[model samples]
Target: MTQESATVDPPGDELFARVPTEVSVYEVSPRDGLQNESTLISLEGKRRLINALVAAGLRRIEVTSFVSPKWVPQLADAEELARVLRAPEGITFSALCPNARGLERALSAGLSEIAVFLSASEAHNKANINKTIADTLAVFSEIVPPAREAGLLVRAYVSTVWGCPYEGAVDPARVVKIAEKLLDLGCYQISLGDTIGVGNPRQTREIVRRFLDVMPPERFALHMHDTRGTALANVLTALEMGVRDFDASVGGVGGCPYAPGAAGNLATEDLVFMLQSMGISTGIDLDKLIEAGNVAEQVIGRALPGKVHKAGPFRLRRSPTRAS
Candidate 1:
């Protein structure tokens, strides 16, 4: 729909307009969502959750990260998980890699699509990957080309684009510069991450607007955390600005290992529900998406933070109890 047509509201219309019907939600609960959980999920459980996500009509499932087991013990089974997960047809399974070694392990485990991550804020970058922002980009120079040479589709992540937990109030210009470098290094898509959930609609709009000036929104993905409970709202802002791709976690199952007390990524169930309710086509079954959230919750042995995970999908009301 045209932007003007989309903005037109009849009397008593809902506040948030329905998303355009073509947006795609990429589920990352199995990988980004679970990586920072203090609770370790068993190998079989991870596999089952990923399989369930695929069954729920999610085509893009980030499988796991190939980081050092010593660093991220929760994902110690990365290679094994990658080796054993059933690759259903028409599904794209991706793994996150930090450097050449990580990419090497991912490639050996048969990942054709891989993601490398860096932060737009220097302090958060050093805290996250223990390197300067420039040094990290230099590492990508070594990591991205070889992955591309091996026929791997390389996706890059730029974290702390909105605000950093340590550094705080990151400049949009800094985020834009880092993003351009990643794009220049041949990243197919740059996942813009709000690392600590500090972004509001205004900040989100500003960052996305500046970035879109240099790169098409199609080559970008928004990875938001609900730390301040603004993830979905930030998502709405990006959507209004014509961003169509987003990163969400089933049941909101992730946090930064470095950013303490930070919430996980935006919940996939919530995002899908919002999209579907707006008549936007996500190509996912809301019921099945909740099932995937349940699977993640069950594996983690706790209650999920997603609202839909507790209240369930919206449905037509039944008549009041008549069994008196």
Candidate 2:
């Protein structure tokens, strides 16, 4: 046969025609997932969770946050945790730094990758960090540079990008402007968050498209909550738009402490299952991920919101033979 006739199409070409070959799954369950829990998890429990996530093939993990214990007591052991946690090779560990103090703590703890956060809506910003958007940016301006000078990779999260509980409706233009400031402030990547989980597929598409017009897809990531059950749909929309990075909590174990009535995040297992079934690679093991979810559920002492964790992965079976 001729060379042209000998060539064969790859598997799942139709399913993944519009999807990227590989996507980055940034696991945030260690920090965002447990920040609002009422129960105080011991330092050892937290360490076990992080180690479990690492063993499950997650390369990037947000291990903890450096906020004041008064604000988020769940992560009070941030410094201690950071100091004791072992950073194996090939794994990129990150923590959230809210201000100069948090950055100082993270740097002292020997963390190389840190994340900063600000909200797009003024009302949400005021509620979350007790500052206006401009004030938060000013704080970030001071925080980002020195952190970069310290040879640290800085990532910024813009919360309430879709809608705010206090403000009701947020303007996407304002979000874009805030993102530009973050990029200008030297944030390596910007994760747009639907802090209250009010985004639909249409809104996700529009906001992502506008952002892509100004910045490359590689510079952006989606941190979606499943409050309205649209998180997975939003992920699909972003994937179609060539966006590859996503933030998910294992076992759907997170909620915004500032945004009232917001639900947990899109479960990492569910996202991985959808991606793998479509032939897109996430470098995560589904069974091990489920085990991690179980750990989270046990630690939190409640059933998680992830569908796959409760119902298990979908399977196909053969039909029975006729009795006659």
- Count the clashes in each prediction: 1, 0
| Cα lDDT of model 1 by residue, 50-157, tens digit | 988998899988998898899888889998999998677778899989888898799889977999998888888888889998899999999898888899888888
Global lDDT of each candidate? 0.86, 0.90
Give the top-scoring candidate (lDDT): 2
Per-residue lDDT for 1-324 in model 2, tens only? 576686766665464366788999999999999998999999988988888899889999999999899988999999999999988998888999989999999999999899999888888788888988888899899999999999999999999998988878888888888888899989989999998888998999899989988998889899999998999999998998889999999999997988877887999999999999878899999999999998888777899999888877887767688568
lDDT of 2 at 49: 88
Q: lDDT of model 1 at residue 34?
A: 82
TM-score, every prediction: 0.92, 0.92
